[model samples]
Target: MADLRRVTVRAKTPSEKPTTVDHLKNLIDKVGDIDTVIGEVMSRMKLESRTESQMILSQDTEGSMEWLSTNISKINYGQHPRFSVPQRITVLLPLEALRDTPYLISVIDTKGVEGTTQRPDLMAQIEDPRTVTVLCCSFADAPGGVPLSIVRETIDAGSDAVSADRLCLLVLPRNDEALKIVNDGGDVPSDREEGYAIREGQIDQQFATDGLPGIPVNFFQVGADEPEDIWRWLTSRIEAIRTAKVERIKRHVAAADNLVTNADVAKTRQARHTIADTMAKAAERFRKLRPMVRPAHLNLIAEAKKTHQNSIAASVNRKGSWDNFPVAHILGQGVRIDANLRTRDTFVRIDEAIEGLKDDFAHLSDVAQFLENLKDDVEEARKEFLTRVALAGRNLYSPYLSQAVDMWDKCEARYGAGSGYRVDVSAIFQAQFEGDPNAMTATEKVEAQVGSIWEQIVIDPLLEAAAFEDEE
Candidate 1:
């Protein structure tokens, strides 16, 4: 009627190993039944049953250790029974026991244990096993006092295990020599310390060893005489393991957050750069067109002036009568003869030229206004796009850039296939050449010469440069 919970204690005794059997028997008697002791210990810690408890007894000691077997069976009655007394405890030659026990508390005694020499093998068996192996040994009786080489090798094996946190080696030395040997040249006192009388020190091995270096390993100066102290120390160690696990979780969470943050920052910077570069190119195009405005206006004015002069010359002519007439007769023309005179045709030609000039001037004025407004529009768009970049953090850069590109597309559509100035030229030609034969001839000449030059010098180059930049 014990609260076994998720606890298991196996009493292992290899055949003919009387010392091993005796040691387990004595420890059981002192601690009461293994099941009862574990349940009580868990209760003290206020832990509930998270897994089933198991008690494994080696078949080698089936008939040999009747007293221990009967007591274990009695204690484990009515709870989950993993095996019968006669059933053999698998030596776990494969270390399968380590893997199977999720929260294991293995109590191993090296001196009289069957697999003591294969310490490395036992440690290596743990494949990231989350269990604590309490390797108890009286180093004094460790075949030739457990050579430091074997001790180091065992520690190394445990460290190299997949999960070092899951392995803990608790050295319970019987005497001074054993304690000193296990200390492995450290400065811890050979005598007992305060509290648990457990001198908690770290394995003095290099960090290159697989396990985290400097994790404290408890060494009991007093042997089985202080069972309570030993149990208390073991409990504290378990608590430490739990604490370390929580800390690892926190670290992992922080690492994940940092990775996400870095990604966002990088994307934002790239988006910002793309938008800024596009705006800069657009502004530069506007700057280049500003100087060309004056030349365009002058060309229109010149064409208008030539048309007006030609119209006047063709209409007005002083004939031979004027040459024969004296200066007085010319001045008094009415008495001599009325020679050269303004005709209706002359008046009409002059009026037509004047109207053409006025239309040309109007076109020029409209173009000037369009250019000024275009500059303002571009500046405003640039400002708005940059403001979006500033407002939206790096995470939203892509969306903002998409919006800016959409706006630019609209501008392109409204202005011209590629630009506003190109559209302006087309509009001017339409206005100047409509319904006038002479103007149409002039327009064809301007289109053949000026249009080709504009495409070669301005439009084609701009597009080509933009294409090249996009490739990069």
Candidate 2:
């Protein structure tokens, strides 16, 4: 099966001309002169019938006379025998004849008397709205010493008729001297600068206009001996144009996909959500711009998806450190301990364990910061527990209670009270735990144990002390 993405072109031959001696004779009988007869025949000719190729029937006597002589043999026998006839019909065949293609053709007609301004009827034949028009003429050839002013006027008139995008004017210079004359505007002060001032000066300035599509007038030498060289040059240019168009489309699609993939790799929910929204809008734009997606564009999308998946895997691995932290195991068992000194000691060891895992927090910085903040909360809770224990002993009228109270006061002065500690370590950790199964499981386990420990170690002892005081 043929790949739908690849553009294909089928070969085609030029359609045969319908002009015959009988047809020309009939037109000549009605028309007085051969020029009128030829004009009538040309006007009636069905040149538009062949959509596959662009035919340029040049009326320039110098360039196209030989071609006309060889093709139209019946023209010689008429009343205009051995008269100056146009030569060389230039044809630009399309890559795909079925498709509307951009084709440029030039026809130079300098058949008028010297010092007289005239436009050829052949210029009228160049009215295919679908194709781009290029009027090309060189300063090398001038019949009967025709001045440069007349030639300049002719070129200026042709270019003025068409829009910049659809029309291009190419002026070929025979030598370095002719090139200089063309560049200096050739004694004609006109707004239309030479599109391609070839050989010496730069034409880049002429095409630098903002918002207007560049009308290129390039200067290049055409060798009579090496005609194949010019054909190769033209073919290379056509291929370059095609390649540039394809690459431009590919670049736009790739840029859109890359933005979305980068957003997927972000750590924070707000950042990720914001960027994802942008990506969605970009994707919509791409879809509208390129409705028929190519295989190359699909490949870019696939690569972006693969990159996002890889980033997710890396993120999961980084979060494993938090999941494996033993905060829950230490607090769960320590809360049930009967001895006050031992319970306090267990918490000190838990603090040490948290401190030890600091290096593991490199990949997961937010989780590490939460753990650091949790240390301050734990210290404040310990100070409150110690003060309550001292109070409970004093209420029982126990000996050494006075000394314990003094020690509690000193500890409070040194470490500050737990009431002012308002850091939300659990909330911070929960933010990281969302959408992650292993991390959520670990967080739930730790939270359940921490809740149990807070009630048992901190609340239960205070409640028992209050009951004892009431009984006295």
Candidate 3:
């Protein structure tokens, strides 16, 4: 296998100037103008029908009306006169006067002579005041059950409102409610409808009435090509639109760089403060958890060291001496020798050490398992506790058997029944005769003879009885 190379590339900061006040001023001015008419419609829409001009204007009682009126006149004459308004008691300036009254801004800008598809971008520019009732009427719904007259009226009226630009009529077949609205209004009863449903992403092209073929045909056709091809084109078109948006953002940012203000400085300071606080909190939590993690890691290290030392000792003993395997030695007159029982002691020591190593290994593994499960169990318990607290409106510090059960499960997973977690105790005896497999030590030979007698007296009888029991 070839070694793979992966390198992370970082973006370089562009040499750009800070936003200027003029740029913010322009954005604010345009946004304010859109907000004005939206405010009026919100204030009076429920009171009157769509055909009626909404009228619930509050009077401005503050000073500097003269200056404001002059500014309004300049703006009205400055741009397209039909779209711009003179400083009047009209709803078009409500946002400009919002200090004295409430207002709304159209998410979509439908007033301009542009296609429906272009309006979402304009809406995206405006911040939602969270007061508007956004209706996503799809044209596919036109064929299902929705009355065409009602749909047309809704569009016409919404478009006339200041916040019409904010209206998000999806014109997709997905919205069953939209289909019902349009299909019902048709001259002939609708057979079925198709298109994307507003609440769900899947196409709601299935029509209840037979007014239209499907959502793609009735709505979102784009009129240039087949619906399937158009859908494919739209996928790429949406990406291009997103790319274009980046350029628009660049332009806005460039413009803003020409202007600066104390409010902007304050906002920056507040953001930095928030980031610092979050980082500090994270650091504090990690510091608190360090003590808990350290003990478990140290225990694991100690267990591993013990196991390594025992393994080395067992290996040394296995290859170090052969005195225990040979016959007993005896000498008289100034020197004496006898069978070495010390060898037996060494074997016992090896067995003990091996047992300890295995026990420690199991303990360490248990600890690791506990740690692995600790986070999830704690989180789950915390959530359960929190939920109880919410329902009872108090801290519930009751003891739980559930946590005990979880600990048991963790233990079993790591080391339990048939886990083969036992120490390599047989290694101690095997080590004595390891060098020469053909030859047995004195103790091994005696043990083998004792084993033969014991098997006849105990093991053979047990085996025979067990065999007879099975036959019965």
Model 1: CA > 4 A from native: 1-116, 119-121, 124-127, 139-151, 154-225, 256-263, 267-472
lDDT of 1 at 276: 39
- Residues 41-101 of candidate 2 have per-residue lDDT tens digits of 5555433442221243444434354444453443333222232233432343233321232
**Leading candidate by lDDT:** 1
Taking all chains together, the TM-score of candidate 1 against the true structure is: 0.27
**Candidates' RMSD to native:** 42.6, 37.4, 38.0
- How many pairs of residues collide in each model? 0, 8, 53
Q: How far out, in Å, is residue 414 in model 2?
A: 99
Q: Model 3, range 376-449, lDDT digits (tens) per residue?
A: 23223322322221222111101111222332233234333342221222233223223333223322343333
The C-alpha stretches of model 2 lying farther than 4 A from their native spots are 1-135, 140-169, 174-217, 220-225, 252-472
Q: TM-scores of all models?
A: 0.27, 0.24, 0.15
- Please report, as a residue range, the 10-residue window in candidate 1 with the lowest summed lDDT: 334-343
lDDT of each: 0.35, 0.35, 0.29
Per-residue lDDT of model 1, residues 1-472, tens digit only:
3333343435465544323234344545788888976655545533243233344545454353453546455533633233333212322222232223234454433223221232223333332334444544343432122223234433432232223454445555554543353343444445444212323322334322433344335555554446556667666656666786676566556545544544344433443344334434543443222111122222222222222222212211221011221111111211101101111222233234334433443334332232233233333332232222222221222232233333233323433344344334334433433544554443244324433333344334333332312223
TM-score preference between candidates 1 and 3, better one: 1
Candidate 3: count of backbone clashes, pairs at least 3 residues apart or interchain: 53
